[model samples]
Target: MFQNLSERLEGALKVIKGKHKITEINVAEAVKDVRKALVEADVNYKIAKEITERIKEKALGQKILIAVEPYQLMIKIVEDELAQLMGGQKADLMLTGSPAVVLMAGLQGSGKTTFSAKLANQIKRQGRQVLLVACDVYRPAAIEQLKTLALQIGVDVYSEPENNNPVAIAQNAIQYAKANHKNVVIVDTAGRLAVDEEMMNEIEKIKKAINPCEILFVVDSMTGQDAVNTAKAFNERLDFTGVVLTKLDGDTRGGAALSIRAVVEKPIKFIGTSEKIDGIDVFHPDRMARRILNMGDVVGLVEKAQQAFDEKEAERLNKKLRQNQFDFNDFLSQIQQIKKMGNIKDLMSMVPGMSKMMKDVDIPEDAFKSTEAIIFSMTPKERENPQLLISGNGSGSRRKRIALGSGTSIQEVNALVKQFEEMRKVIKKINAMQNTGKKLGKIFGR
Candidate 1:
């Protein structure tokens, strides 16, 4: 997720970071490095040059305060320009009609089908009845793929397996949505390996027939410069309402995200962060710019947390923590909640200063597999009362059994038990301190 670009930008900014003041020579040096970094990241040479020139001008024009350093101000200027380049603010989907039709468009293998389902899932979560329409009658198993994804997200999908007319299918799907009381209908159209006249004409017909409120051009962000070019072609014909960049979780150099808006003149409405149905996110240009600069996105992190965690469950956990009753069951529930927040590494990178530290660190998607296995192997009693495995005559035997059941070593079980015990002790100490503070407050009341 722009990891290389982040590092390069950091290095570029270091040129003026240590300087006592800003100067034309230093600004030029840093701007040159910044341009090179953007180019290496697959950004168009012209866009890179233009952005760098703006950065240079802003950097030289700033009246540095006594407290503000050259580098700090320089970072701020770059962040602003980057945000402006990516479409100053987030562009939301316009669901205007009674049964708003959101059409998905893109080349084959660009993730339109997957994004359609993801978008459906997102809208469904918002309490809207979303119907996913499978209009991709060209590609093999395209209809089946959409159905499977729709099933996974528990959303209704409208498809006519026997009908080859995508435009008719889309039209019928909208009618079905209207009759079924659906609020939104997302029509996933067929795409070709390359942009062909037939493909374009078919999508155009679908658009004209449906008169969709929003036509999203889904492009594979991993395609780099080709993504920008493809977007331009599609925008020329369809005049898409917005862009959806997929595969941001892949080895993307981030050229598409940076260049697409400028070239296609369309705001990026959403980003496919991962392959999971819940991995799609609304694009926020300022947050992404901060992330590219390694400044982290605390707001985005909090938003993810809010979406993943339930208020009732959080209150229950808080009560358990206050009473020092946190156990393996509670811990396992916490792990599940964290997993719901998306990729572990991506979540960590959202914390300030963690991105650079985790750049080279390989945190696998299944990092919690062993821990989950160990927890699952434990008996209900042991899960409820973790102290049962800490200080009893049969504790060692219980641990041995758990290790065998979890396919782990006895030493691993011992390490987990020790860590859990330490965590409980810390919780107890915090609870005790809180109680003492309450007592002091009651006694000192005037």
Candidate 2:
């Protein structure tokens, strides 16, 4: 996502490298390069020109600090401008009504149905009773797809297989939600291959009927400039409250995310990070700008970690680690939590400077597959007491059985056991150091 754009912008910023001050000639060179980068990234030419002009003006007018390098100062200006270009602050979905109706709108294949289920899962996690209403009656399997996703996320779905009227189905779903005490109703509307009068009129009618609290225009971010154009047309008709940029994990040039808000005057409320239902993230413009600049998003990474880690489970694991009793069971649990946090490369990219370091490294999604398979093949007792395989000098048969069960080699099993023991020893040493510190504190009475 934005990989090419990031590299281009980095090169553009380097124009001021080794410069002592921000002068007209160097700033113009930098601005020209930046404009070219935006155009190559598929950003709208007019919007790109306007943004670069603003950046140029700010760069020339501001006073440079003696301590800050020229390149650093230019980066700061561009970051702020990028954040403002993509909406200066985060925009949250408005869910105020008793059953807030959020209508999803976009062209066909924009991921409306999937994003609806993702939104339902997100709202459900907020302690709200979310009901997903499948209103795409024209599509044959759209309703079924939504139902499947809703089931995976443990959210209720409302649909009428026999009814062809989307408006009526939406109304009925609202009534059903009211009766069933569902607090949020997400209406997934039908979309056309292209914007047509009939499709626009139908969605407008549904909007009028539902009186929705929020109307989100979901767009495929990989579509580049086309996504921005589609957004303009939809906003001209539906006046959507926010935008959902789907497929951000794809090979996106990031034109839609950077240009849609400037063209349509709307905030991007959410971004689809992956194909998983749990891959949704609230759009944060500042964090995204930092990421685009290769500055990393530590706050976003911490939030993901917090969401993935359970407090009670963490406390239990901490106790076991302190007692030197951590085993494969606990290890497997931790692995599952990390897997739930989404893609491994994405997670690691959030660390400062890791993005550049991982550019050429190919970290597969199933990097933990072998480790997990080995652990799952273990018996309950064996999992609880990993020493059974790692402690003895002659545990060849046990390792061989585990290898066969997990479809791995005995050498692979041996390697895993060796790594696990190494981790255990490190944890023990850390615990011992902490214990020594505590004892010394008690004795010194400080």
Task: Identify the candidate with maximal TM-score.
Answer: 1
Error of 1 at 288 (Å): 0.4
List the global CA lDDT of all models: 0.93, 0.92
- Candidate 1 lDDT tens digits, 1-446: 99999999999999998799999999999999999999999999999999999999889988999999999999999999999999999998999998999999988899999999999999999899999999989889998999999989899989899999998998899899999999999999887534588878888999999999999999999989999988888888999999999999889999889988998889999999999989999999999999999999999999999999999999999999998899999999999999999999999888989999998899999988888999999999999999889997799999999999999999989999999999999999999999999999999984
Give the lDDT of residue 144 in candidate 1: 91
Candidate 2 segments whose C-alpha is farther than 4 A from its true place? 443-446
TM-score for candidate 2, please give it: 0.96
RMSD of each: 1.1, 1.7
* CA displacement after TM-score superposition, residue 435 of candidate 1 (Å): 1.8
Among all windows of 10 consecutive residues in model 1, the one with the lowest summed lDDT is 191-200
The CA-based lDDT of model 2 is what?
Answer: 0.92
TM-score of each: 0.98, 0.96
Q: Which candidate is the best by lDDT?
A: 1
